[model samples]
Target: MEKGLLYPVTNAYREDQKLDGLWDFKFDPASEGEQNGWAKGLADPIEMPVPASFNDFFTDKDAREYTGDFWYLKKVFIPQHFAGKKVELRFGAATHRAVVYVNGQKIRSHEGGFLPFTADVTAAVNLGEENIIAVKINNELHRDALPAGDTVTLKNGKRMVKPFFDFYNYSGLNRSVHLLAIPQGNIYDYSTSYEVSDDQATVHYQVAADSDADIKVSLADEDGVVVAAATGQKGELVVKNPTLWQVRDAYLYTIRIQLVKNDKVLDEYADKIGLRTIEIKGHQILVNHKPIYLKGFGRHEDSIYAGRAFDLNVERRDVNLLKWIGANSFRSSHYPYDEQVYKLADREGILITDEVPAVGFKMAAASFLGGLDQSFFDGDWIDELYKKHIDQVKDMIKRDKNHPSVLAWSLCNEPDTSTESAVPYFTKLFNDSADLDPQKRPRTFTLNEDDTFETSKCLKFPDFYLLNRYPGWYHKWGYEISDGEAGLRAELDEWQNSDIDKPIVFSEYGADTEPGLHKLPSIMWSEEYQIELLEMFNRVFDDYDFIRGEQPWNLADFQTVEGNMRVNGNKKGIFTRDRQPKAAAFYLRKRWNSLPLDY
Candidate 1:
């Protein structure tokens, strides 16, 4: 079975409940919840909003940064009429680890912090009766965990969430929770990949069912006209003179899969699918066989109080901002975003570089602090991390494979690829992902400035290249303006000479600038300096044919761990945390609007 089988039914033709809004919440700091039987019911639980982070609610900073077990309890009343149907409790996402219990009985558990998980509550649920849906959530990090970190106790005897990467570890229910009363044996999974040639489309599709049932699949255009229809478990449907999905010119067709028997529609499932193709050819990325340029930012599914939760109000604003800035593509950065983000991208013709939450990944935490050695090789730890890392890759690929917006799959972000021992890990991961994806999207990983093609043997694994370099910010900070440009140019020239025929995108590149800070001479933390650095980088980007895309470090300022270098968070965003555009946004808007989307 595919890893996506773990995901909820996307195209359920039956009735379901959206378990949004407020729920009874509590923090189990002492870890005595099981002994106290908190799962049964909390004695004095405070009301907290669902689909948002619990960190931002408290007045104390310590409460906001708590990393241990927290509970979200809700009482749901299932309708008596839906008793015969199979009901499920689906969570959009829970932080690092989650345990679900229904009516005091443990139902299921999931480990991923950003992926959806479901539990069957048909037997546990009391129809027409109020039932307790209790969830015990934890965000403590282990070395073996994906995006590994550690829980450290300080000299004062206080534990802290010490992350290996940047960004605040906001924990809670970050996405929607659903109560799906779907049919017992309905269409669970289906996907479509297409071959489009301007005027024609040949769509290959597959459907998975719980049991044997006659299936009728149809392709409907925007006009609600069925272009092609078929009957089978898997087959091809052809449409003459079909419209192709394009960046900023997206077109889509509805795929309706119906379960039929004896002239009766047993159950039907439907979703909008875009007909597009992606390919790679000699240092260029092709969309629908046409070489295209990617113009966008590396955005996170993050915000003020919601943290990583999915909010349509914020989502719509973000989409409008991207469109207003003349951007046609974006990377999910270190993690996969909510499913609705992809849906919006598909409709607006926005391209995507779907990524996994494999950030903070390294050989081991001890290796970095012990001797600061770059070449520490451990057989046992490598195997353990690889096992955990590859599982996330499969889950990410399977859940996001069908989206037209996703142009490629990013295995990780800025991992320790400079080490020689890391070569086998990347190679193995890339190979494992190839087998899981049906779309066969080009796979790549983001490389930091330290990971050079010459030094890192792991560089050979990816289909393309993505480097995160901070020229003016990190390498040539003290150099004069002209000298810094030359320094950046030198690095690019060396990369151009490397002779690797693959598309290279600067997945991250920017200097942290305080929003209103400005100086005539241009200095660090100054707005002028930020604009100047970006303009210089853009010039260098234009000069290289192999550099197909340039996504600045972030779309907006986001919360991160408290440190001297960080003013609340990473200020590398073109916009502030509230989505207000800074000097960089305007600069990119003008440049992106003027550039040709195709090479």
Candidate 2:
């Protein structure tokens, strides 16, 4: 089995069958699955969907709040088409972590669940007959994991999750699962880089294969006309007067690659690519050497019923809503979203800062101020956490390096950087991640409220600054509007004088508002207050020329861990959870529509 992440595609040499449907599931609150031989089959299993979170589908609170080992079993059949072919089970994602067992034998174990993984189950399956596949999933968060959190045990001997992050801990098979069949000596992986001249663009490509063979590549435009062709594992293809992939106006080219020997094609792979360039020149983020002012929201892969599952319908609706609001870009806040989401972004011409799942290293959840503990960096678990973090980073870059819509790599979101240890930690990480991508896109990490201009030790690490501030909402709530504005100005003044010339993007800033709740004199949790707070932030943003972008805290309301701070879920979304417009939606639409793409 080749150990590379190549997106599964259907062609003459490959076929993908989605293994998404109802499956036998059982919750292991006592963690007795392995000991009881449950990996072979769950004795008394309940029916659940494969590509969905089991939390919201259940009626009881225990099932919805489950925080331990769970098992899913599904029966699959391998088609009889002779022999000597490669077959694998590819999971788009399994929440937190998962271990696979086929026909009562352990196949593979994967960690860090937001990315894709494949297990070569060719030998374990019975060709032309039914085979059993069992997966054991664990959702207990540890300090040594990405998006760090703790697993607490109660006096009743039940386990629960206390995530350092604010969002709900939705777990299970949250993305599509597919059974893939491919020929031997298939194309394993590929990457592309670009160089633009006055009227031409040259694309540099490198392909990896399981066996050494003659590599042939061709680039085709929208009209199905081949613009460029090359023969080699690594070569360049030049197109005259190339149509650049612009923000909100995307143009894509199809790249087809093949492995050939003695005039016979052994394997073929095709993917869509957009040629563009992104860089930070002084205080502006330039796309194709032109400035871009991002007007969007920090989005989550969340919705009702599906939870975090990759729902194409919801994804389409969200992108349409963003376009309706005149948004040009968005950050995949906190974690890497579904791969299909990025593909949609490429087609729709939406810019994205593709982030990894490295969120919430803070010591607390409710307030960033109270998280003063440096044990997250100083503890013995730091190395393990960093290793897992770098592993996820490598996976993220490998999976998404070629997408033109991805403008930058957001390394972390709101990580604790108050201590001196953050200096070396982030320095090494930033350098390592920069080397992984062929384009060498700009790298950034969102700064929390605690990591101010003077307090942040890793301020100089990123190519640009992505700050998540809640001046009016978190710092100065209620009638202290003037004080919040003054505090915001004070912070901006300090940043301006700090000699940091990097472009600044307000990655997250918003207030939670109840739908239809209003008051004559605006108060917290009221729709009027949410609008008032955002307008205040916009005024301050316009005063500073260094501010390059504004993506409010959220695109829509989403579920969060149950607490007194949250009612049902986080209500900070400009749109309601069901994709209906809130008052803030219209306000943002008016403001964003007036701002040009280059503003």
Candidate 3:
């Protein structure tokens, strides 16, 4: 099996087609699809949208939360012109796990679902003839899977996926699908980064190919003039007066790579790169040798009907909201988002802390570290889960390493890093992640609040600190607002006196506020209480210079597992589910807008 490309380039520069719209779907509850030969295609199937989750479309609650196998069928005719070229079927993403078959012939089986995967179906399908494409996707989160969980069948025959994380398990073909053609022995993979000195920028690049071929690399300025060119498998190109990619002032250069043999161009690829460098220096995060503060939110890939599917309209609106709130950065909380978001971030100069979807290590939903019994390190499936965790991190870095907006890489979210057993697992995971990326970007994890700064076995591995704290909401109860503020200040003071020299980011802060709820004196779950909590936290940020960044718990309300503490889903967003602003949103906008661009 061939390895998938690091950055999946489309034939959009050439010949490609979007395999989106509607397709036939069926649920294989008995897991008898293979024995019954459903690969040839289901005889009669229900109509399902190509890229959307099948949960909300169904009326039966049992079907909405079904934990078994579901099949999707689509038919296509490969044009005769694609006969000589290498034809491939690419799925943007299929939840948890998937198997693809073309014309009743098995093509590929992929483990992780959040990243794109492709199968070289050049020999599996006949050109100029209609071919049946069938995919069986499963969202069952056993211990060996990336997002680990288990399901239980009730007496009513309803399958319920237990909550290990704080997000909904909306599953299906949750991203786009495409069919593209590329020349054989083309530019298989490449990586590029820049180093700025004085007024000049040097681009160091490497290209990998199937066979020995002449590699041509060019850097075109924003004005469409080729500034520099190189010929080799790996080399450097220097450009003068490079326009550095800055916050809210994005400037990019186009890179054109070509494969040439005997002066004949066999294949070509084009991408954009930002000429800038980022590093962490002395409790300060610097970009292009200047310190810049991070103000954003921990965001999720969620929508009303699409679930985790990528929607361009939603993407535009979300970015607009971020701009309105004066935010320039966000952590890809819990998981890496769709690739389109990364592209938009690059274009808009939005900084990102890219994260992998290894989210369920805590096993406890509400209280932090309450599920030591369900901790990832002590599980019987530790070896298998650790391997899967490593692969997920590698896949995330390889796919997202080229993007300029990605400032850091998060290994996991809210995991128990406080145990002795977690030491070797986290140390090896962070080391392997660094080995995978050529640039070796900053690495960190979302430190659970239960883990103290001094005792956390893995905190020393992160380049900086990303903490999830809820002072006013969670702890120091049975007290007035002043007491809550005092408790929070004491905690910060302890962290400051601990003499840890790393820059810290308050990754998760803010209270759950229903859109219209209000209280005169301020109370939990009300708009006034949410604002009060944030204002109190804001005071601490002003006091501590090491607090380099602040990203609230969430940007908008999103769906999660059903529970009594949650109303429909988590309501901790400054904006409502439909994109309306809450009272806290107004206060947050005012505060963020006051910060200077360089802050």
Candidate 4:
């Protein structure tokens, strides 16, 4: 049975919780178990925390990097009072691939690092006794893993690699781990689809369950007023809207589903669904029949304290800063984010573009193509990588499709260099998404620039065209005369005049700046430089009509190997790394909200 309730896992670094402790670890070079016979036999034991990487157990020299199979073991006990309860083992995240074992019995295995997966361990756990949990993880860097290509050193002594992107890849249980107790028959998965007409609105509720139980479903407004209710033998219900939800109106309704067995409410789940219509026509993005511009930024799911580990306070801080800056949207850059982000976006009225982690080039492909070198495409790994990426996309859409804030399903980020190979993969993903839910259309891949041959080639595959243009930041235009405003206008005009005939989104555009660092106007990552750049872009935005939206390079200062030594990434956030607001914060908020800034 699929366990559907979302539960919080312990943050990976709680010293007092005993969830972050040392564990017995061994690496296996062969496909078969040979290192310590741990995978086959479970006599010798070591201890590890629920939310830790194998590197935690290794010494300095041995832990620097990991690139093979590593096994982890830990003994946990379920209290006698907790016995006879339905217990499930949930993993917040694990890198590459992982197989889980409980008491030496294989329970489940999963692939991917940014999403959550679970296994029902009630049957495998010995009731009221100590149970051993083992996890085997495999990490292999391959090309065709997404963005294809290699490494380079810019003139400023800054380095750029094929992960051609930013952010460190911290392998292991980087998210969270939790043990949940629930009733025997419970709600598995719940999703809602909304449709609106002139008079009445219809919402379809689909639910999955573990047993044939009676389910009660209800729809209520912002206030606790029920507008609809129904009981079903199977897990399906329908509701008619009393008041629909829209961005301008920002009205949301809650759909609550409760499982009833033997005259008792066993488990309950509720989804916050908004009623709205989104359409793309010409070069405008319309929500509920009104044109709206997406003044936003691209985001990475990394924190200074937790890295990629789950931290609710950090997530709240990120969303709060976005609202404070007057930005209305964000792109989950390069990868899908925690599910909670989507819910917050819905509640806060922020538009979002959810993306998958189909990034980087493999080593072999980089050598063969002489382009950017990324590990995602190495060694004839296209089919496997594509399948894995597709699975991640499916999981993302299925889990978060009902969110009103999700504007589009971004297939990939700046996968320009490998257009030919990436197009088919994106097409399949788009088609599959359409089949699953017809409410949202698949937005094809995004390109870094408009003139690249790859961009023109892949234009036909997507429903809309999104270009990531940073002319003032990257082009060879003279620094003496800033092209910040002119560059944006020129790129928008070029795309508007192009024969692609698809709506254009300024997918990425922004400059980086240290929050309080003052420097010369020409230098990047300084408050002065970032403000100048943003002001120019904001002016162009005021005059342009062809562009539908603009999502700046980033929302907050994120950690990047290249960013550390040389501010290589556009540190162009309205807030600092610790979420302190910068001077540009007020400027962006004013522009996005159509308010005039005195500065």
Backbone clashes for every candidate come to 1, 0, 1, 29
> Which residue pairs of candidate 3 clash?
293-599
Question: What are the lDDT figures for the candidates, one per model?
Answer: 0.82, 0.89, 0.82, 0.64
Relative to the true structure, candidate 3 reaches a TM of 0.96
lDDT tens digits, residues 284-362, model 2? 9999889999999898888898798889999999999999999999999878888899899999999999999998776
Report the C-alpha displacement of residue 10, candidate 3, in angstroms.
Answer: 5.5
Compute the lDDT of residue 272 as modeled in candidate 2: 94
Q: Hey, what RMSD does candidate 2 come out at?
A: 1.5
Sorted on TM-score, highest at the top, how do the candidates line up? 2, 3, 1, 4
The per-residue C-alpha lDDT of model 1 at residue 318 equals: 91
What lDDT does model 1 reach? 0.82
Q: What is candidate 3's CA lDDT for residue 115? A: 80
Using lDDT, give the best candidate's number: 2
